[model samples]
Target: MSDLPVVVAARRTPIGTRSRAFAQVRAEQLAGPVLRATLADAGSATGRPLDVADVVLGNCMGPGGNPARVAALAAGLGVGVPGVTVDRQCGSGLAAVLDAVTAIRAGDDRPRLAGGVESASTAPTRSVDGVPYDRAPFAPAGWPDPDMVEAAEDLARADAITRERQDAHAARSHARARAARDAGRFDAEIVPVGGVLADDSVGRAEPLLPRLRPLFPGGTLTAGTATRISDGAAAVAVVPHRLRGGAAGLVVRGHAVVGCDPALPGIGAAPAVLAALDAAEVRTGDVAAVEIVEAFAAQSLAVLGRLGLADDDPRVCADGGALALGHPWGASGAVAMVRLFSRLVRAGAPAGTLGVAAASVGGGMGVAAVVEVVR
Candidate 1:
């Protein structure tokens, strides 16, 4: 395997709520702003204009053409930079990040700009239930389950997960999110878009709390605890090392992608993380933080439970999670990585401090990467 690239710059857009101003924005609109911000961040970090070797982007939906290419142009990027799009359902962003890292290690590219943007505002057709098909007949042969939530619910039942436990986990996510946001931890990786300064929304016009109580019946997972249907886009970037430090946060230590049974859908990420750790030759406890894509309350909790992690890891869904923060399919992974790296940078963690990012795909597939914060 090639050595991990030196990540020069990364930036993410402020997440917005469903039907908010960001809802009408195109991937070009979202991706362009962050790309410029990334280069700017790169210039400051390295004290020079980054010669981007490649661009890898993640987006679940957007204008038909290459949003990455459109973003490059919108950001005034030059032609020598080749770009590719990655889609793995909601996991595309992390996948793009891994692909970029893999390329850098293999000497295929240097100083690459890789990240993702998900414009839920422009999401293509999907079932009201978020399934990929309108009718049973439209399903593919041997198609695994289409809905992640349903599979998670099934996993809960099979594992005998109690509703009370699910509720508590959801609450913890919100409380941590509240604390993190209040503490400005999110500011590390977020760049305010050029045109917008603050987020104003109907669902998130205020803090998450009892007001969301009504959203989750039986108090199993309160709206305050769950991620909302928010519209937003975000990006992160990587490049080769001549090393000038931005914060010297992390080096891409090792990355691996593994497959698992698709029957349980979201549960696939569970094995994916384990496999990545084994592949990277790192132990679980050695990791300082873990960012598993929480598609649902149960799915998020399920992975931790399987790994024997209790509610408190100081690892956060702070700022909430997909249930509360909203899941813009394509941008979710990049957002998760941005959050993890930002947290590590703030804490001044050591090289031994490892972080994991995982996401689930339709038809029971899951993918993830392991990053070591190389200070």
Candidate 2:
């Protein structure tokens, strides 16, 4: 417990719209540069050469062949540095960070880089024997296995989340994101990608959000309220607490991954957050900030309402979320952590300030982690 890990540096590529600037860029292409840039940032910020022992990344759709290892070499991390990848759908990136934290807690003191990348523009069309398919089922036989959009609708129905509420939340997301971008809050951590310096998806969607129709019949969610498919990559440098040195940092306190009803996957993040906070011996009120992936405005609202939090909870996504920034599938989870890093660590929040990063998976699972600002 005393040897918990801490993030020394974090960086991510500017998220690109689907089939736009990053259409030709592969997942490895987005990941490799961010990996190299994170290491460089750590070294330059800490004023010391940090040796990375492993590179662990999360990927949902990349040509199947250990993309982490490929990205490691591409980033010039060397053939000696070990690499591994995890797949948990949308939660993959945060899960990767949890795995690294676990490894370090078990006594591996070497520095490691963990995050995720997604290039939806470049993801290959999956097929079975030449028949095109959208996605594989999340549940087994006799289990409810609805596609993501359907699951979100189910969750909205179950939680009584209204279209008006969803639109309001999404509009708020965009407004906050645009304000943050305008203030240059994102510039410090966003690495240039495909010649773009800022996230291209963020805008003032409030005025137009309420006019958008539902994505599915009888559903409350709309394209304006749901996250956009995007291309981006994010990585963070983690080391043993004793070795941590940087601007200001976050210490890994606790983490949990829990399962829920696959038919209503959007609600998974709440249970995961409860489990993680319990594991860390902290209460919701204790956390100074929160980052729950906004897969859909309905899903996010469901989580907040179930947790007894308001949609406008100041602690959650104070600078906006996936609804505004766009969701790069695997990369969105790490992007949440990067947001928390920017607010609590880089911005120099008071000592002992607690923050959480959490996301729901496609397979009815949720990954949540707790961190403390080391002021």
Candidate 3:
């Protein structure tokens, strides 16, 4: 591991529509290619897994217990390389990345494989998933009751997330995202996978903005404003180095994971970020950018208000966020990280680039991560 963990490379796949049944195969099938490409894009061996530390990953859906382990082995990672799979619901991807950073910064391990892979194609929608509040006998013990959207509505009512404010936020997302898509800001980060219906690579590289219709007439959040359920996976490789001359190396500095009540889902990330920022001793102002997953238009607005981030700030996902792009659950974290790293490189500002990615699961289960891009 470098004296400090620098993000040598980052890559993400386009958000996918699983139920749309676009003839796309399984989740792992998609994750494999992106995994290889991420390594290659970094000038590292994409196919040849590194010999450094461990493999860490997170996923929301089941069917693949220890997904990180399975993904690592399936994608040709080193044999016997310890693999860990964590479930932080929406924050699964960030959680996985953080786990690797924590291990390295704590000196428990160095040069580890840290990233997240999520495929909505593998799991059922929250409606059919029997997620506690949706039904009884919650087979998935960790799956809390009450859907994330319901929780967001509740929060908005209590916190005064005005419909107008939410609508304005959603509109800005579409406008800004469309602009970013036009400008090619996401070029360096997005990985073009095989199965794509859109002629352009990044899904929204070609605008479908004309079709911004909502099922409800006066809906506060329109289809243009919310994150779409998508299918895809993303991964990044991290290595350690011993910088000579007492220099702080360009490596991932560290990461943190915090626990909070699952009932309030969207706002759950506040505690996690506080703990992470404390461990890194970094402040929000010092952060160059944040990639908070936009689960819903209202959800994102609520989280931003709580975090005190300016909605129009250039530092937060300079390239359109999940609302404009899409939120593919497991795939979204990698997507945010990939874009954040690219922006950091272009800005050349922070020695330690910080990225914040948040997600909301049913109940109050929210996950957050703070990653530093060194080099």
Candidate 4:
């Protein structure tokens, strides 16, 4: 029996713009349905009832008292399964999945559920010393800590990414997402929530993109070129490869997490991807699919350039990304992995087809995983 972890099922809630369809939903509420659906899918694939050993979830700005435990209980997983929450900012979801992979590699063969959830609409306001603050500092004092928007603007200037290019990229993302949705390409992986069956943020933005003003003075980034604040959840079921029962799935190969200069946080994914590919003994040209979180068009373009990919590479985000689907912070990374699964395993890609999922985190860090289709 192969000891490697294999993802047999993946699902996500329809992403909603902040203060919109999911405004009344809590973090655990958003996560519960997807967890239940993922477990059922995994059970159907393996043709046996799974004794889930644990539940691992990631979150950013939700009311915290171990949300993962609450979600597991809410999903009716029984009281026997223990749960743990992970926080790596934007990389939380993928990191949680990697944690499960680590456990399976350590000889614990029990099935595990791992993913991330975020409720931007219902996130509690925080205070420090009686003064309210929007978010905690990403870096400690004496470090270059810039707001994400500001960092994107700085990266645009440094990389000489033109305004026209950013606008075009964002427009392309929206068009692709719209086309995919229309063709029902997203139906298989989405679990309807809050009466929303489809992502609300994908729209025709080309006309409005060029009309928007720069977010910062003398900067190229505009609201149209940046991902919207959103609420959503995504989860996947992982089990030992021996239990796959000849079913199609993603076999976990290698993963890496690395940090870069805080000032150029948007470029962090480049090194992490390189390291992950090296660990898997795969080359850049050999990957059949890639999904990198699209927090900002300029930031994504910069990372792709560093990785020696063209600005409009078809292999990357073939059906669009966060810029069109919306960014739910911690859940975005897991969403990327789910996208890779749908594009490869669900689409009938042959065995041994390689794919990559990655995200450039807010605090100068990157997380990436290499997976291959197997039967």
Count of steric clashes across candidates, in order: 13, 0, 20, 0
lDDT tens digits, residues 1-375, model 2? 346788878899998878987999998899999999899977876677888989989999878688888899999988899899989999999988888888888888888999999999988899989999877778989999998888888888888888988888998898889999999999888988768888888884667887888888777888888888899999998878767654467887878999998888988899999999999999999999999999999999988887789889988999989999889998888988888889887888987999999999997999899999874
TM agreement with the true structure for every prediction? 0.86, 0.97, 0.80, 0.99
State the C-alpha lDDT per candidate: 0.68, 0.87, 0.59, 0.91
Question: Candidate 3: lDDT of 190?
Answer: 61
By TM-score, is 1 or 2 better? 2
Which candidate has the highest TM-score of all? 4
Model 1 agreement with the true structure over 1-375: per-residue lDDT tens digits = 124576656788877766675857777778777888877887787777777777788876665577787778777887766678887767888889888877876776557777788776666665656668432221367756445545666666767776666666666665566666677776667767646543333234235444454332433434444456555666666765544444365566656565666667767777778788887788778877788777777777777776677755666454555554567777888877877777675567775678887887656667877777765
Which stretches of candidate 1 lie above 4 Å from their native place?
Answer: 124-139, 194-226, 243-247, 316-319
Which residue ranges in model 3 land beyond 4 Å of their true spot? Answer: 21-23, 42-49, 78-82, 108-110, 124-144, 195-224, 243-254, 350-354
Best by lDDT: 4
| Tens digits of per-residue lDDT for model 3, 1-375 | 345444456666665565553234455565656666655644442233345467776666744667777766666755876677776666777667766665666676455655666666556344445543322221257655555555666666667776667666655666666677677765655666665522122334225434555435544444544566667666766554441122222344434555555556677666666666776678888777777777776777777777787656766655656666666666566566666666665446456556666565544555555666444
Give Cα distance to truth, residue 60, candidate 2, Å. 0.4
Assess candidate 1 and give its TM-score to the true structure.
Answer: 0.86
| Cα lDDT for residue 94, candidate 1 | 85
lDDT for 11 in candidate 3 is: 67
